[model samples]
Target chain A: MMAADEQQLILRVKEGDHEAYRVLVGRHMKHAYNIAYGFLIDHDDAEDIAQESFVRIYESIQSFRGEASFNTWLYRIVTNLSLNKLRQRKNTNHRITNLPHQSAMNIISPPDDTSYQDVKPIIERALHALPTLQRAVVILRHLNGLSTKQVSEILRCSEGTIKTHLHRGMKKMKTQLTEIKDEVI
Target chain B: MSAHKQIQSQFYDYIQGGLKSDEHSIIDTHLASCTMCRCKLEELKRFIESPVFSPELPSDKLPPEYWNNFALEVEQKIRTYEIEKREYSLSLWDWLNSLFIFHKRQIIAVSSALTIVCMAITGWLLYVPTLVDEKIALPEISSSQFMEIDQKVGEYLHKSKTLLVGISNLDLEEKSPIDVTAEKKASRNLVQEARYLKNQPLDIRSARLIGDLERIQIELATIKDDAAIPRIEMLREGIHRGNLLFKIRMAESMYEMPRLMNVNNIYSGDRK
Candidate 1:
């Protein structure tokens, strides 16, 4: 939701207007989905996280003082849920083979013609390869055009920490994509 | 750091234009002269600027209906969530008000029975011990042998009380078998002595007390090194149940105070 619109909707919801809450959810749901998509690469998982984030926003709206913009607050919930899902996936300790993301390749198949345009699927493979936080930092900064300070607020970290993560992430992306010739061939 | 590494470090900041002009100029100068660093920066830049980087749309598409019904779905979810939460946590007044609304007779039956049972338990505990106390008075000692026997029994009871109190006071934090070895030995021995005392010819109070103390001694003897806290709690519950601890203390003092007065009376008669 936009900052001013969300604040008014929030005041109405707090005053027990359920319709105002529905308006807020409808307005912000797509941005929530995109934010979730940035962190979690799957479209369905992105929708699930976004929906769950809205549910959380509804449940915990009483504690929302609107000190931070609702836009930032919504993004924070989506990011935290994605990170938690990542941690749970890690704890299961499934062995990760050097296999590529099937979802990434199915959509972005390179043509047989030798062009640097072949780098699309390879970039997809590279993007999904980084750790959860690094992937999130890269996506939020590069795709969404969030500043280091903005990314820091959403991820709940210092600006310096966000920069460190963003750099390490971009550097990893550089390493993996540059080596695409060896992997894709 | 080498010029190459230094330029590499600032490359992201340089691309974002976050660097101060002086720092930006130095990196820009290095990049102009350096082939490898410049190539790395270009590659990184292209990857960040790609369709892969800006996937606000998913690579795979979702249904139009999914977006359309999302708010209504979320609102329905919130409504269901509220209903479920209300069912889980009802305020006392709310639950009672609802109970009266739906099932007044059943509520009255349950509350009335609960009150009666609570009162019965309280009255029994209070009244039974006082009646038992009254019925078990000591015999009048008329001879020196009787007095001597009374004195021996008194000493044994005093020793048993001291041991039981000490065992009760033992901290459960002491975990080693050796830490409780003395208490265990004394308690085991007290069980046998108390059993003999229960069987001896005595007033009803003495017999009842010996029985309680024997049970208590057995309770104490069974406490394993590590299970002291729980077993001590069990012992305390039993002691409290029948006012057993209070009776034992009263019997010990009842025997003691008169005996001290008699000694003084005999001494006065001798001086006369």
Candidate 2:
């Protein structure tokens, strides 16, 4: 939530208010975890990055000079930390295994929702297959529901570039999901 | 039809609500008439509207207890981090305290005498320097003055590049931190030089490059002897993000090319 209320929490946080810090962490932790999850499909890695991101922000909160909104700053940190994790994974030649399909389907509260169950892994794999920038644009733009302008700010690129990446990323996912559509039709 | 091509391009913008009303109507009309376009739009919508892109995390995926304790866990982590930092600083003091316990009186007497001698010398030195320093006037910087500054900046950039490359090429498996001591020392000197050049009258381009250089140089200079891999990786990321080495090389070439041309012209004149 890009509410002005965070400004007060941030000010209190800066003044060493532990209650304010707790409030701030509670408010943004899910968003941070979700963004990290968007980059890293693994829940454990996402949780780790999300927790570490908040810790980094707490340590360097003095440097957070309200230049951009707090959410934007948090998003940038989550995004960078997630990318670093991915890079580390790559350097170590580690592979993240996908959850078993039946178990993944079981996690959905309404197991009767067959469409989402069928397409969830497919969509996730397509997203994972994207180039880093395109995947980031799609995740921030679509998954996080940030505006293109916000995505551009977070990615530090022009809006045109964001649009191009978004367009390309969606097209790829759409192609991958075409089988589901044909089955439905 | 060319209309179909144009309409396809707007599908993303249409779904995003980013198109103007007129543009939106054009796509709507095209989709209504063309079954192919309608199906394509439907396909995009299906993918875009999938629960995978939802902002809300699927509740069942994570236990409720996890959310309940997330904030507390973050706070606990932060507390642990602060304690570790405090202990790191406290260790330095503890070392000094132990030394003082062993040689308390001798240390006190020596420190007291040294302070008195230092204060006396400081008083004499401050008194003498004011008179000698007051007569010196700041001179206007000529082009050649900045040219010299540019040369020094170029040298600084070269050295910085070498140090960064050295850091980059270091064996990641090396457990020892002392290997970076030389690089850190060189960065410290570059930081001093950067500060000096920053105060000088230089062109905007030179000034900006130096500003970026100063940031990374400070990071490099302050790298702890016990720095972890992540710390060094962060420094490398900063260099990559700013494209610092590339910019430095471009800046050096911009400054060097002119001087090289001038030297060439002088040699040609002498030959003539």
Candidate 3:
């Protein structure tokens, strides 16, 4: 979204324009949900956090300084809140164990012209096993197609740290996929 | 550079698509010359370029209902925020009107009293110095003349006191036992008083008095043959140091009061 348009929408939302806020949420909901899902690895929790993040954004829209891009700032908030939820879940020993598993044959098999359902579970599991920072780096780099510098700014880290995480994360994914090959097949 | 280092550097550049023509030429030459580096580079390239599957776009699988539901939820949240903002603004307006109706008379009375106090203070500041001068005439001394006279008087007093002590060295300690004892007792009393004052809030008046008593105690100890001299000197030095520190603290306190007062004044002015 053009920054000028987003700023205009934010101003309207602050002035109690529901339509303007709706437009903003409609534009950003998928991105926000994807980011939350990348961290929490559960659809329901991701959806809840994504919704909560929008509500928070609405509440604090007045305080948004235009120094950083609105999308970048929103991503930061969503990712941090998702990570906090993950930490809380871990502390409570609420293991998220409902992820649907599929056999290797089922994943690699042609299924009525559907390619996504077969691979999504494995990919999600691989992404969930990554360290938090590494997962964020991978999602930002591959899924969002953000530059390394942009990822560093959103994560509030140095570019060197982003590069290190990306390299280590990719290597780890390669190793994990090799280990999972037998089970999947 | 070592083959590994050269290859690693090139790999990052190649992955980022930032290799210049010259660097590309170098890499090509290396690839032709070194089989091991070339093989490693090929593996890295293949890994980077390989496609990994991901979830397909939801818009393709799901009907328009999915997006409509999401849009409706967003619209509902926005409406809630709008209602909250409207209610807040209305409450704020009601609060301001109520304040004006309830406190108008009190505010006027306070303002009048404040104006009268300010005028009285201004008049007093203008006239008090003249009134004091008229009531009590005082002598004036130039700075240079005062210093010269003080130095002369101090020298004369010091010489006379030394000469008198020397002449009275005839069992002086025994002849004036009462006076000596009174002086010793007074010194001990001053020390105790200083210790007590040290424990209290260190203000300018207390600190000054403590400094003066400590200086006198130090001088007397230097001239006397009492065992308490060393102990008294230590105490005296401690009190003097404490007074110096207290002086800094007193200045900071004085400065801070004005700062706080200025802030309060600004806030009150804004309220008015």
Candidate 4:
């Protein structure tokens, strides 16, 4: 049902129908919100950035070119804007400090369910310690399920560079998890 | 390769999808055969699939009013652009009015005055050419006289060649004929000079001459028998031909130097 609605919405929006724009905003809001949240890690900031991204998309509709799927382009814009905002916040020295080291055990696991609840916060703390660009690469590669080529296009970098970042990021995360495991033992 | 290094390299390639089908099959077979590698691959696959963090869904949902505020901001910016466009159009109209509407009489007066001045300048230009044609004259010279002058220049060049050959023979007689170091140095210099001359544009006649001279120099430098006087004489003839070619190319370069200098000046000016 959502796929059919999305196709219809895209056709209508391409024809310059304002009503179609509204439908698109409604349909994609959750996905856009999730991407923004992934980077900013703050609900309010994510919502604001997602809304602004939609507005910019509407104004620049003529510039879409349609070389990539609409969802890919929209997500790329939201991710870039969220990362830029994060960079600005870091520069202003207004970043949040002294947050507790969230463990990964709290995340819901698909297979073991029981182990997930204890590991989620640990995973989150380990992710936060990763360098920002590497963290972004990992999230886009794994969580978003984007191929290396797609991630490279969205990140405006070579596919090789993206692979290197992913490799290093995963290695670092593995090391961090091992350290956490030692502590637990 | 050692087993550990081979496994590490294969694991890296497998993860990257860079291995060929044959190599991939080899790795797969090894994994199936080896329990340790199979376990490592499984652990890596599970770790990558695991989530980094889990966040609670947002609770303070934005009311529909927020979107309305965003739409209003966009509308205001668009309206401002429209107003600026109108002001720009008005300024352009005022400038056109000053140039054409208010100054129509001045424009007509200037046009008639310019036409009379142009007619007077055209008459003077037409009359001056015939006057100069009648007064100026050019001298006549015969083609045979020009040819004689060219032959004299050739004779002078031939005399210079003979003088150069005499000087070279005297130098060779004075020096130790079998000194390997001197012969090597001379050959090296000849090679360097030949290479430099090759880079320059040479006529067919001159190029063949230089080629012959280079062959002579090479042979003379390599001579192991002092008794080879006939071979040395033949090499001398080759050297003379080569020297003649070099002289011809040098003369042509001298003629082109001024034009080359002008091009250099223009290039330097562009850099500045």
Candidate 5:
């Protein structure tokens, strides 16, 4: 029954129902952006990948049988595109810049709370310090709040592998935070 | 220190409720009894549940307006892409139409002659095959032969299913406990049978199944005891993507005995 509704939405999108497409995009846009952002660590690049992912979805919605859920399909696209962007960056010999520290400080509220601003960059730095797979596991499992099973499905690994990556990633992040805290104190 | 090490290794999984029931209970009992471990768990919790970690957005949410424009921007880009594609196709047609404008009659005449020549060649090719087909007679196999072939094919399908199930059910987390020698030998045996069966005059579906089966059997036959996790995962993915086990079962039940006995159609290579 859920599948029937999903198919109906897809069919409406295929039929050029603009409102239906909008609804579909609205439902997943934040997640798609955040997941991409988690990978790219740059807002503009994340937004580009997210929009491109949706466009690709719209173009190919005709071929999408309800085999995987729409969320899975969208995430797979987002993940692949983000990975491609990373690969392209590597091939071009460009260093992956750290998260935009000043930009982060500007957006985190309440703007007067200096401590919150200081800690945000530390968290972002610790997140970026982990290896790519571990970071991806962290973002998807913790930040995105996807279940371990869903993360495994999206990442195409066994659930055991996902759990291991999550465990390692969290441990590393905690270590980084503590080390930094001790240094500051 | 040793005891704490064992329990502490599980602290993250414990906090996440990712432990199995027995493990969870073990952690629970230990935490209740050990004040030091309880403090450790509290510290871990405070660290994880810190406000820095719980923000809905990883960094910060963009102003609401940025999100409001996001969907519209995607739709507009799609429209632009569609328009560009249509215009590109239109330009290609215009180019072709322009090329044909000058020598229209000559082009038409040449095209007509080419079509007629192609048709004559195709008709001759189609006619020549029938003449050769009329002289060839397909030898009839007796019922006994059909039954023997069916039995062999059925056994092959069942064995293939068993092998795949074993590989699929392997507990990957266990440290290399696979009976690789036994699996490799079974695959080798299947490969030998598959090669012999591929030459049989079977229906198209059965033949295709044999072909796919042979490919995977060869993959299995090559697996070493020290095969890497990625290699094992690749094999698993191949089986899953092809849906091979289910197809083998279907061929076993539906195509083996009764379908093989329909000798005339089977001999003619009829496809379902």
Candidate 6:
């Protein structure tokens, strides 16, 4: 949450006070990095995304009417930029991973002893399997625990679209994981 | 619609829990009696909870080093962007200064030349009206100077007669001491002058004289070397038949004598 005083700092930044911008960035840098990291799951990429998002925010701050607080606007920027980078990465290397043929097929069962580490690859595969919008919605709603309404706001999509993506994403993961769980049992 | 497809389609909306009361109750009653939809709703919960299935957003903090210079780095990027944006904009004064510095010698030379040309044009504009006024005043003053004009015309006619008499006496067939080529060229020039003089608004007798002079000059211009004897004989016969030489002498006397007598009378009256 942005402090009430942060709005004053935003005003100063709009007035060309660099120190005010620095303070605003200092306050929100951690939150921005976490959101980007949650999406990209990379430390260096997250940091880069955070920095770029701040630069974009600074450049377009004059047009920032405060209806959606500076944070949601910043979230939208970092999330959108990270999503683009993910799409570019997806396009470059479109091949599936080197799991066993059976695991790759559908079951996605963790090899022998099931642990979070063993399951991590399966979860990541399922998450990336989703279409880009669905993946964003799932990450924002399920992973980040944002409400469907908040996810819709971040994605600038209708609540119905967000809900549809969220439900479909979860359902696919459930079907896969249930099959794996049936194998483990 | 199949019962299964209807349940599957509304599964997303139903899971998000925003369905209206009537719609919710309808789906709820169907789910209560329908084993497949009930099982599907149960699967939705189990999947959201499973570690093997759910996406982890990795909210763990990044390393301390990552945040250390983070704000400074962003501000530096912002400052650099601002610098680049400013460097790209050239104000009018800066543009003019650059232009002046780039072509200093050419600009100075062109400006100096233009200044001199402008001064010349201004002088011409001012001086030209005076020249015009003088020209206008001149024709009016020279309006009463017709006696002088008539005398000048008489003198011009007297000069033209000398050229005419020379050509008529030069019997080209005999080809004597007269330089015939030079005399022919002179006569050609005299023809051009006579043509100009013929157009002058003058007494009918003078116009007729000029007209006769031009025709003789043209016949002289076309004189064939082999046919020279016959052409010259022909031309002289034509002139004698017209009695043009006698008419010219008589008109010159009549025109010049009156102007001279008038001037003499004026001088005499002034003396008395």
Candidate number with greatest lDDT: 5
Local distance difference test scores for all models: 0.71, 0.77, 0.63, 0.60, 0.78, 0.70
lDDT of 1 at A97: 42
Model 3 CAPRI rating: incorrect
Residue-wise C-alpha lDDT for candidate 2, range B106-170, written one tens digit per residue: 99999999999999999999998886666434556677887787777777666666667766776
lDDT of 3: 0.63
Across B39-77, the per-residue lDDT of candidate 5 in tens digits comes to 877876777788866645743457667778989999998
Stretches > 4 Å off in candidate 4 = A1-15, A100-121, A157-164, A178-185, B1-27, B33-36, B46-272
The TM-score values for the models, in the order shown, are: 0.51, 0.56, 0.56, 0.47, 0.60, 0.49
Clashing pairs in 1: none
Q: Which stretches in model 6 have alpha-carbon errors above 4 Å?
A: A1-6, A17-23, A90-117, A175-185, B1-30, B53-55, B87-272
In model 5 chain B, the worst 10-residue window by lDDT is: B263-272
Ranking by DockQ: 1, 6, 5, 3, 2, 4
TM-scores of chain A across candidates: 0.78, 0.85, 0.86, 0.75, 0.86, 0.74
Predicted candidate 1 versus true structure: per-residue lDDT over B96-212, tens digit per residue: 799898998898899899999999999999999898877555444457855655565576576666666665676666555335556666678777777766655667887788887
Question: Model 4 reaches what TM-score against the true structure?
Answer: 0.47
lDDT of 3 by residue, B105-167 (tens): 987898899999999999999899998897555535566764544343333223222222322
Off by over 4 Å in 2: A97-118, A177-185, B1-10, B18-42, B50-60, B96-272
Q: What TM-score does chain B get in every candidate? A: 0.38, 0.41, 0.29, 0.25, 0.45, 0.37
Per-model DockQ against the true two-chain complex? 0.26, 0.19, 0.21, 0.15, 0.23, 0.23
lDDT per residue, candidate 1, A1-185, as tens digits?
34676688899998889899888887778777777766555555776788889889989989998788787888889889977876765688732343333463344433442333344446656777888788888777776666677788898888767767777888888788768757667
lDDT of 6 by residue, B1-272 (tens): 47765665566557667578897888889988999888888777565555554544343323456566899999888888888788767465688788799999988999999999999999999999999999667545354465655665565456456656655786564554333454455557667767766654567888888788778878877776666667766877877788877877887886673433332221122311
lDDT, candidate 4, residue A118? 63
- Considering only N, C-alpha and C atoms within 3 Å, which residue pairs clash in candidate 3? A104-A184, A104-A185
lDDT of 2 at A48: 88
